[model samples]
Target: MTAPEPYAPAPQPAADDGPTSLVRAAIWVAIGALIAAALVCVVWVLIGGQNGIVGRAFLTILLLVGFAGATILDAHLAPRRPAWFALASMGVWIATLLIGAVMIWLPERYSWGGFSRFVQFLFIVLILQLVLLHVRLYLKAFQRYDTTFTRAVAIVTIILVVALAALLIVPLMLGEYLWFPDIYWRVTVAVAILAAVGTAIIPLVNVLFAPKKPRAAAPYPTPYAVAPVAPQLAAPSAPVADPASVAAPQELLPWPTYVDGATPLPMLPDGSPDWGAYYTGYPTPGAHVFGAPEPTAPQTDAAHPASSGYEGFPPPPPLPPRP
Candidate 1:
């Protein structure tokens, strides 16, 4: 049989469809949401939405965007795409889109007592999310495009983004560049414009310049290189495992079948079994599979030569004179 290859390619991972039930998880979600709402309500009651109608409008938008971001994060990081998190995240996205649209288009009508400057920030976030979603849906590493096509896409994106950036700011530019004279307002406008252009350019730049083919991961370094297989034969019969070597079992002797503490009774020098004390000593002697010999001392034999008599186990207490 042929030797096996050094490594087999790892299997590709499939997306998890995830569990069907989210009902069990809904209670925890509800509790968390309630706690958050209570905290926010308390803070707003004390501090109020950053003061003023414009400030309040901004605060409302900020809150919406923040909540949307958190939900999106939950969806992304949640284990196994659990139904509760997924549905909750989608619901948040929908709410954000709706509220953001209302605030952007009709700031005066639906504007709550929240900070106002945040409306444009929400717009920027919406644009970024949409662009990200597009990349995920359409970008394919396996599919290749002509260089000209990619360059065109990148250019068109850049132009559209620049136009949107202008349109997003032009209305506020009326009067003296901005309604609110605060330096922060100016900073917000600049940040929004930068974000818009960046959001457009980065993703397209990757599409245009990045290699379309998926880069194969470098094979892990191995101590030995495999001999190249010939293409002529269609996989010479799959390799068989080498037969394992094991030692044969040894046979056991019968007469001395080992059992815990199964022993013959002790003997006196006169060659008689000392049954009285021996029986007392052996309270729980184990019985061997092959019976032990009679308690007589060893007879003349090669296994146990006759004993040249010796003192008793404890020498029988100094002969206990005169007693």
Candidate 2:
């Protein structure tokens, strides 16, 4: 019987392929609009936002920008991202826009100065939060397409935007008074510009000072060891004198232990301390002889024959024969 073919999974579509040209063009258009809107806000701030209408105008413009950014973000990420992810981000965006708009409208309709001050602060906070969140999202999502130049530009732009937003703290403190001092405004602007320019050069610094990879050491050249010619040893020459001369003593060395060292020497039947059975003569060398004064030539003397040779002392007297 023929074997069955293995199962194969169906290929899922790519993220880029999921969006049509029209949708992509729309995304680009939205991106361009966001850029243009940012430029307009910068221009407005530069052109002396000291007018009495600054409160209403800036808030309105900012809220509209946030709404557009949030909407575009929903479209940009939804196709690629999971449903829950899209829903969560988009929901927060819309919520911020709605709350800000309602807050703005309530103060205007009621003409409450104290309430307006509160709403103004609330409004500033909301706008700043939305701006920071959206910028973070945009930058993070587009990292795959980032270049060195684009990254540097983004860093500089972020610094400028944050610095500009900081100027609002002064306006917020003034609260419905509509009085922004010229020196403070000029100082804030100059600082923002200088910071943006200075911060932008960090990418260049990274390029210049990046850590270098360490070099691999060359494998130390191993010289082939010259095997010594073993001196062509002359057959070791029969070890000079005789086989009897270098032969080990017939009694092998004793087994070693601490007790063995402390034990008294074994006595011979004749009551001498036996040095070893193989010892040649009584009083083996330094010992004085007993039967005969001199160590009588290691001879087989009938009565006291050369047998168990004591190391030093002469053997004690033999026991009397049994009756």
Count of clashing pairs, candidate 1: 13
RMSD for each of the candidates: 26.2, 26.9
- Could you tell me every candidate's TM-score relative to the true structure? 0.24, 0.26
TM-score of candidate 2 to 2 decimals: 0.26
Q: Once superposed on the true structure, which residue ranges of model 1 sit more than 4 Å away at CA?
A: 1-30, 35-180, 213-323
Writing each residue's lDDT as its tens digit, candidate 2 over 1-323 gives 97766776767877564544544555555566555555655555566445435675667577777678676767867678655445445554544454454444333323465366566757676656655564565455335345677676666766676666667654764545456678987888787777556444544544565444699998554222111211121144455467777756343233211122332233344434445522433334432222233333433557765454467666533321112
**Candidate 1, which ten residues in sequence have the lowest lDDT sum?**
314-323
Following a full C-alpha superposition, what root-mean-square deviation does model 1 have from the true structure? 26.2
lDDT of 1 by residue, 270-323 (tens): 333334433233212332111234333312445533342234333211110111
Evaluated at residue 259, the lDDT of candidate 1 is: 24
For each candidate, what is the lDDT? 0.43, 0.51
233 Cα displacement, candidate 1 (Å): 34
For model 2, what is the C-alpha lDDT against the true structure?
A: 0.51
